[model samples]
Target: MRFVAMCSAPAPLDQAAIRVRHTLMLLALLWDADRARVDLAHELRLSRSATGNIVNELLAAGLVQEVGQREDGSVGRRATLLRLKACAAALLAVDLGASHARMDLLDLRCRTLGTRTVAHDITRGPGATYSLLAGLLEQLLLETRIDRSQIALLGIGVPGPVDHDTGCVVQPPNMPGWDSENIAAELGRLVALPVLVDNDANLGALAESRFGAHAGLSDLIYIKVATGIGAGILLGGQLHRGVRGGAGEIGHISINEQGPVGRSGNPGSLESYAAAQVVPALAAQLRATGLQTRLPDPASLQDLLTHAAHDPLARAVWETTGHHVGVAVSTVLNLFNPQAVVIGGRLALAGEVFLDAVRASAVGRTMHINAARAHIALGTLGAEVGVLGAGAMMVDHLLTPRGLPLLYSIARRAGQPVAEATPLAQDAASRAPPAVSAVYTPHPSPPRSHPYSPRRNT
Candidate 1:
């Protein structure tokens, strides 16, 4: 059930063909044109001829086109190329981080058209965050002059655990008023479009895989070390959104029982010692030990981190912080044999100091095998990642297992009785498909062979 991309092009057939062409062209670019088709065929296990046939079908469907030629050092005529047209489809994206929210307009090519950010503490007063988002989105669309109907999908990336299926944010130990918020339903109603949501770390991992440092890699982990720490895990080339979507809370791993009790009541979680808030107090304690330091007054955790990088005592504080972070990350390394581990967020900005301890602790504690494939580095996406991630989250949801809005559309058709609809839905369900399957699953049992008639199968 492919979406027919709406085109502004005048020629009807050409318009549809161009839309399909653009979509496939974009995918080829993402897949790396030189190697992708071959890889795709290999992955799909289609022989050259069969693959060529499918490519022809895609061309016929207006989803793709042969654009150029590729030479694999063969003697005869080279293989023709395929690529997608980028402007045929569009998506909507939102990123809700601890400090702010950002909205973006994206095309099917994964190219960004417009973006707007509402800068405010998301953990602030009740309704402040969502209210800010409501206005921000309105202003962005207005400013960009983009039509609403052009947006076919909406994606959001929240700062904390989200029920992957429902897009609801679970109670964040740090953000007090966010629990019970029905993000999906509310946003769905606001935009009149399909809404998809996931946690920020997961989105960061997605960003890395789709468009950043870990691009083309099969197994990678994206770690963001903000006020709190988290990990975005990618296993076998896909995100592992654990049961309830709350799987990436690496900050909650208990590192010190004797340290101050953290938000979730776990004594000495990784966050307690490594979070921005705790660094200053630890620096202050270092000062009390008769060590001269510049960290005299700590207003923001970032301030302490800045001093720690230069001042000896502050460096010591970071060393300790890194140790704690390392302990927690070591556990993760042991558990996940990832190809890369990306460190991000405010804490990661501490650069080498923070990473050294994490690396030392991890290497010392983890088995050789666990640490073998892992490569630790900072995030390459920077601040834009959160928003980009938010946008990407929606795009991923729309493109993944959860297919399109066909069922909903089928339901809305006038005079289509429920009895008549059951068979259509079941037939669609029985032929399980990838990506789309993530979006919707039909009834497990056969539709009553006839909805209005007595069932004969039973």
Candidate 2:
């Protein structure tokens, strides 16, 4: 009986095991440096054979490549070094702000190969936006000289609250015509690609945490102060999206009940005072007072920052703007006690003057313990943060336990045969590994009105 049982073919690998192996391998490469087969095996605490199987599958999927031999001054044969194939698959990241649309073509390593930004009003609605995006995508491909077939995924960051599960923008105050629009479905139809959407501030937070100067900090807050103010909250290394995905709508948080109302109909909101739009008007008011300063009449946000150091009037305006932002940030610090508060967005370009005022006001108002622990700083990625964040999010999703099958499917489409290319894929259904006993069930995306069909020009 024992011999018969031992000789019987094993069951197929369950969803859990496939995901575990794929995620472990991808994440191990993502963080580690100059990995070899032996290094991964030790890192994952898996047997050499199991690790090799996972590495082989990754290689077949074109997600990783054997770079060169590791030089550890070994006695005999040196192990081949393995690294993520940055050019294995292309990803497009779009950052749609209230007044600008920015697109970046990134490789699997999240390195930007080409980037373009165009001025466009979001209030024009989704149809116009999609058309513009399609043109931009074509232009990006042409500029980078990359074939569209190599593209794997598209990620978008919008200036609004997003229902991530459905990729819909929900009642965003800045985006007048985009309320409740299914961004992913509409945009996916235009480009014929798998699309993921998230709030711009959320992406900024993710970018700062993963790729900024303070990379790897688990708990951080990314505050975006632009045409509108918002925050992305990361607690314990995960996004703390509220029940309705409105957790970081800090712009609407009321500082004074009697203050003037803004777009969101929130009285005394942070956005009402400190948004980038307010800077121009505020500067106008100061100039009207005949305050002798180098600032131009009706100064732009850029002008304000340019003269902030030398001009007294510019300093006053920034001080005021930063104070408003800082007051709101103080509340966040006290409530969340994050490790760092990273300021980003268009207005953050003001640099030290803006950051100093924010730090002063926030630290002054925050509770002693919270103030002591939280370090407020400017973001390092600049205007590219949103797109980078979106790319990072997509990468993370594709490596999740539920995402391995989709990744494998994408790899298969890119020319690798799942059954023949991967070691266990051939007889996985009948030769399940001993550790993979759980049942596997795939949850496909809901059928779309406009199903994905590559829209590439031959």
TM-score of each: 0.74, 0.85
Q: Which stretch of 10 consecutive residues in model 2 shows the poorest summed lDDT?
A: 1-10
> What are the lDDT scores of the predictions, listed in order?
0.60, 0.73
Expressed as tens digits, the lDDT of each residue in 1-458 for candidate 2 is 00000011124767655446544444434333457888777755778887887778778876677878988886999999886555666778999998899998876556677888999999999999999999999998888777776677898888899875566789889998788899888888889988888888988887877667766666889999999889999876567776656789999988888998987898998888889877888888877887788766767788887777778888888888898899999999999999899999888888788899999999999999898978899998887788878877666555544555565666557474212112211221211111101111112232111111111111
Tens digit of per-residue lDDT, candidate 1, span 1-458: 11111112233546445434333323433323323356546644556665566566545544355667886797987766665423334556787767777776655444556677767787784366656766776786686565555556677777778765555678877667888676777777766776766777887886665555555555777877776677888776556767667787988888777877876788888887777667777877877788776555642566666665688886787788788878877788888878788887778777788789889988899999999768877777777677556544544333321232422222233322122111111232111111111121111111111001111110
Model 2, backbone clash pairs (residues 3+ apart or across chains), number: 2
